[model samples]
Target: MKEVRLPTIPEIVIILGAFLALVFSFTLFLDLPIQLALFISWFFVIILGVRLGHSYQDLQKSIMDGITNGLEAVLILVSVGALIGTWIAGGVVPTLIYYGLEFIHPSIFLLATLIICSIMSIATGTSWGTVGTAGIAMIAIGEGLGMPLPLVAGAVLSGAYFGDKLSPLSDSTVLASSLSKVDILRHVRAMMVLSIPAFVITAILFTLTGFVYGGRNIDTEKVEFFKTSLQQYFDIGILMLIPAVIVVVLLALKKPSMPVIVIGALLGAIWASVFQGIDFADAINIAYKGFAIDTGVAFMDGILNRGGIVGMLDTLVVIIFGLGFGGLLEKLGVLKVIIATFEKKLTSAGNVTLSTLIVAFLGNVLGCAMYVSLILTPKIMEDSYDRLRLDRRILSRNTEVGGTLTSGMVPWSDNGIYMAGILGISTFSYLPFMWLSFVALGLALIYGYTGKFIWYVDENSPSDETEYKGEKVANDY
Candidate 1:
């Protein structure tokens, strides 16, 4: 096997320039608006890629590859948009909110938010879907309950990410497991050693905070009005659930995503026409451009009205740019260089673990996309893990705990921005209360450095020279 070497000095400088440009673009202290910063960053990346021996054709190819890599994510995101619209059009979200408000005490709302999202994420295998829908509802319920916005946002993020890390349905989970050559189920089970403890600690903290905050008076009448408006606009029923069920069923069968999402969008349109009395043209329009309801309630408008291809375009754009940058870094060997420099210094299992955690975290901070971070980090660390005789599951878990958890904490990152925008809370404001994410990272680091729960491959393990019971067990790990 041929080993890839680190970057040359010029390549390092180019990589540094890309980082600086991205930082300058997103730096609030620089007094540049976010739009301008993003534009500037894109410009800088293009110039830097060209200077680093990438031709226009290469850049285009990179963009195409990046978009292709993210196609599944993109389809899921768009389906999520339509799903949110359908859920609203069918009154599913409003019903959840109304019922949530009735049952949840204000003091425990944050904790409840986390638990609910965690359950939904686990079931759906999609943190993004949980956030875009149930997460949105939770934010509204939190506001009605008078809980602090940041705390509510933090709790929602904490729960959503917990599921993303452990859920078999999650793309990040699947990606990590696949890249590391681990069975998906095994990967998820192995993560329990670290994930469960982090979740428990986070839940406890949120529960304590909820008790400290106490309950508040909610506007029952206002919530009732929103519920009434939804009921009036759309036919609310168990049948409205068909679209979600179909999507899940398809995903479970491991079908390609684009066709599934397209079907989902069609189902949304069909539901709108059949149940809401919307004309075919209007239903199609709503599915593509989002639904608009004249509920005459501002807060209701904020919560109940969302969906469409247009709504997902921003996130899609970000995914494209982020992945493009990551691909360029990979091609230039900049990421490889950094990982090699760090790997050479790690002599013990403890060091390898810590280094993996740090690498994962840095990838999140730099790439801000969980899949990008996972893909880049593992490739960089694969040889190191082999040298240390560490089980691949450990590296996979570390990557997930670091990348999937921390991406939502960085305001400028894709997940962070989406969570903040959807929840109507700033990432900075909610970051302090996002205890689970930080705790996950901390636990990973501790596990890495202390070797407390680090699993290693056994040297005395049998070779795959002979099969046992019609199966090869020696080479399984």
Candidate 2:
């Protein structure tokens, strides 16, 4: 057996600098596929690891561990692709679009998209569910209303993530609270200090943006074409919404997301065969290959022609490579080395808070999952907070800021890939419109610097008394 050695500071810099340069230049500036960039980065990091005396077998194990950790997210992405395909074939998505195009005014469409997605996410406690269902419908509605797809994508992501960070049912939220040993409800309360203001400001920005689009001359012809085309293709009606309703209800009841999504897909397949008159063979084909139709309306065709299991392949590539790269970095002791460096510099409450936030963000960037960040941040930073007498809930809130909020913006991340794949817009294109994230991140920094909302441990209280005063029950929306 061989012992692994940690890289020195300069060595860590060389590794991280090369990886970040490769990722950003290729994906952001060069406009190449993220998978390619991640692959190259992976190779570069492995070489550095070998040069530092680690064995190839050990490095391989690290990559595997990273990928293994994220397999559930990978599964969810695959399931979502199938769900979207089947739901579209079954008329569930079209019905939502039809109703949305009919009732949601252009003046409030962007604002409404944010608010509706926020509410749905809160209820379901899952951002992916809200995005895959309502997010899809809103993008189409925005297109019909002649709004820019990227702008709409921004609103959809903002709203989806807002609920995801705050909702008790949200996996990231629960993970953050449990990791800190803070009660989930108390964590939620502490988070509201940062999240609510960001939510309100984002909603306001969307409202103003919506009004700008509202005052423009609408292409009534295009809206009519979409509505008519949908009516011509599928049985658009109230009952078509049943599968979507079931998803929200079941998830709200605390059902696991993967099975609930698969159930939705199955119901959609049944509805496609029964109501839409799609044959059994065609339904199966749609589930795998996605729904397709020649609506003759180019815009309509673009929006409707998506979904299926295969549709997620491109996203899966990025996830696999990204996770592998992240895992390799961990194996090479990049995270540990970096944390040790930061620990020496922790001089004040503000510095500790800021460093914790940076580490949390790096966890998502390097680890490829908020779950990884949520787990790693607290396990590493809890002592730092305690050293300063800062409440651990403050640490939990920062995790949501750096980990959960920023996850959607990284091109190779699961949320980022899923959003781009589902909305048919590039992550970079909508990155500017993720107002809530930008604002929340900014507010977190300010609070850290100014010491606002930074709670302290009550010295007079028992050391074991950390849980909030209330009945310990499962958190709801």
Candidate 3:
């Protein structure tokens, strides 16, 4: 097979034009609100997509394909929005917040936040869900306890990403495994070598920080106020468990995501009406406009009073634009050019591993989405790994470490932007405490260079497994 070449001048112009349009849309933030900014960004993306190819018809076709590829993700986000809205209305989120306050002490709140989010994200296979729900509450608790906002945001992000890296249900994880033809469970288990260490070190840092900042008195009044308001608005019963249970059961049964999420949204609406004294019209409104709270406690309100379809629209728009940007790059063959450049330089196991890390990082930085990073990196690096006789597990782990871990560190990236916004901290503020991501990257590089944890197939004594399972083209060089 011949090497894929870089895009010509015209292709570069199209790519640059799309990027500039994205920047222009973001500039709307200076004048308009966040929601409006999102709308503008997506509109720019659509226009850019239409102009990227040969003719208007071709551009329209590309736009349609981009939308089709993103359709499932869009539905999932909408469902997630409804789930959050109803969960708030049904008092599930509030109950979690109320109970979380009771159990978590200020001294170890950071570490506790990490653990709780990690568990929840792993269970749901969604870092975003974990962050939007428990993560927001934890940030509130941290503020009430007098912890620095940046540190708290960092802790929440660290835990949430850990789950995202390993969860079989995660879209990025599934993409990486599927693209490489590796077993999902096997890929997850193999990732623990790097992921576990990063998590442990992160926990230790958070624990030590807790001890350093111990004995600060939290505002119990705020906690009480949230609990009261939640009780006032909703029945607050175990029946709230129905929607959550349905999501879990359906996911466990390996059902397609769209139906499962839609059902979950319906259940959320049903529960909101049954328990929250919400009329059908009001419930529908909340599902779209989101529930509002003026708990009078600033931090608690920031945590508790967020949900609805409208609230999720910003994220949805970002996802669509990012995916569309990636699609255009793919169609123009820019990614293939970038990959070929790396293939020429990667000769040893160490180089292959390092290149994989760099590719994953660059993908996230340029592509601005974890799913895009995961999809492109492995495809680019597969040939390099084969030349070094490396196992696919190594590529899988590298992609997770770089793609999943570093995503929250990039300010313009979805996770980082959301975390910074929710925690009321600047992206730069929490960057230092994103210890897990940095540690994971460093560990991957070290292991690759030292061959301490690197796995490879023996070239001299190989049996019948000469061809790598997912290697589409033999590396003739």
Candidate 4:
């Protein structure tokens, strides 16, 4: 038997640099499709692993394990497609948009979207769910109201991410907290520090921007035409909203997002049949193949002509390739080596927090999943924090913010792919508008470097060091 060796820093850099070069060349200069580019990159990484000492069998296992861990997200994503299909067909989404377009004055549209999405995300604890459902409807309404697609998307994402980070029900929050051995409640409280200011600042920015665009001329007749058309196709009534409500209730009760979303999709199908009089065969088709809405109104048609399990197929393919590559990288032990290097190099106790945040951001960017980064960040940094007498909760908070908040910003990342697919917009289009991401990252960096709100170890009891609390916790948000 041969003893395995870890990758050196130079080898790690070479592997990562090659991967990045491939990504930029394929996605940027060559203008190749992302799915194919990912496949090529994965091949390169796999070959690199073999060039080292690992066998094909080991790499295969890593790829399979990566796929396995991500299966839950895959299923939820597919169900989200089905949910969108049925919700639209059942008149749920259109109904929401119908009211939203009419009542949400353009002046408050962006702010309202941010607030609504934030509430939904916090309740569901799943940003994907919030995006597929409320986020989708919000975009349609924004378009109908003549707002820019990217701007609306940015608002939705800001609120969705904020709520996702703050929500105790959020899977990422739980994973981050549990990985750091911090209480989820404690983590949520800590996040409030940065969360409050970020949200407040983001809200302020949205408001200032709103005062300019909110009063724009609205197309009431066009919007009303959309509502009337929606009524003609499906039963757009209070009853159609029941499925959406059920999912919210179930999620608030802390039921796992998987079954809750499945139920929501199935209920949408049933509602389409029971209330809208859709045929059983057509109902099944809507969930699987999605509906093709052709209302003579081009804009409304464009909004409606999306969703179905089939629509999510492309996004799912991207996830498989991304995670497959991430899995291989994790198996290479490159991240482990890099973390050890960071620990050895950092001299200032304060720099520990900054390094943890930086590594956490890189984890989500490179690892392809927030769960992957959240888990890895703590394992790599917990020892470093303990040695510096930093409270572990601080580490947990930074992990959530850096990892969860940044995932949506990376174009090739899982969160990025899912949001782009569901909203029918490019990830780059909305990246700049993700105010929460910018604000949270900025505040975290400031707090870390300034030693503001950073709690330290009490020499007497290292284990019980949270006695001193930092006033800020946007970390969880």
Whole-model lDDT per candidate: 0.72, 0.83, 0.69, 0.81
- lDDT by residue (288-360, candidate 3, tens digit) is 7777777666665666667777887766666665665555556555656666656677877778778787878
Decreasing TM-score order of the candidates: 4, 2, 1, 3
Q: List the residue pairs that clash in candidate 3.
A: none
Question: Each model's TM-score?
Answer: 0.86, 0.90, 0.83, 0.91
Best by lDDT: 2
Candidate 4 regions off by >4 Å? 1-3, 29-31, 459-477
Give the range where candidate 4 is weakest over 10 consecutive residues by summed lDDT.
Answer: 467-476
What TM-score does model 4 achieve against the real structure? Answer: 0.91
lDDT of 4: 0.81
Against the true structure, candidate 3 reaches a TM-score of: 0.83
Order of candidate numbers by lDDT, starting with the best: 2, 4, 1, 3
Q: Per-residue lDDT for 247 in model 3?
A: 77
- lDDT digits (tens) for residues 30-116 of candidate 1: 654443444455546566656656676766676566556656677777777776666566545666776676678877787789899
Mark the regions of model 3 whose C-alpha exceeds 4 Å error after superposition: 1-5, 8-67, 221-246, 249-258, 420-426, 458-477
Of candidates 4 and 2, the better by TM-score: 4
Q: What is the lDDT of residue 154 in candidate 3?
A: 85
Q: Which scores higher on lDDT, 2 or 3?
A: 2
Error of 1 at 52 (Å): 5.9
Best by TM-score: 4
Name the lDDT value of residue 403 in candidate 3: 79
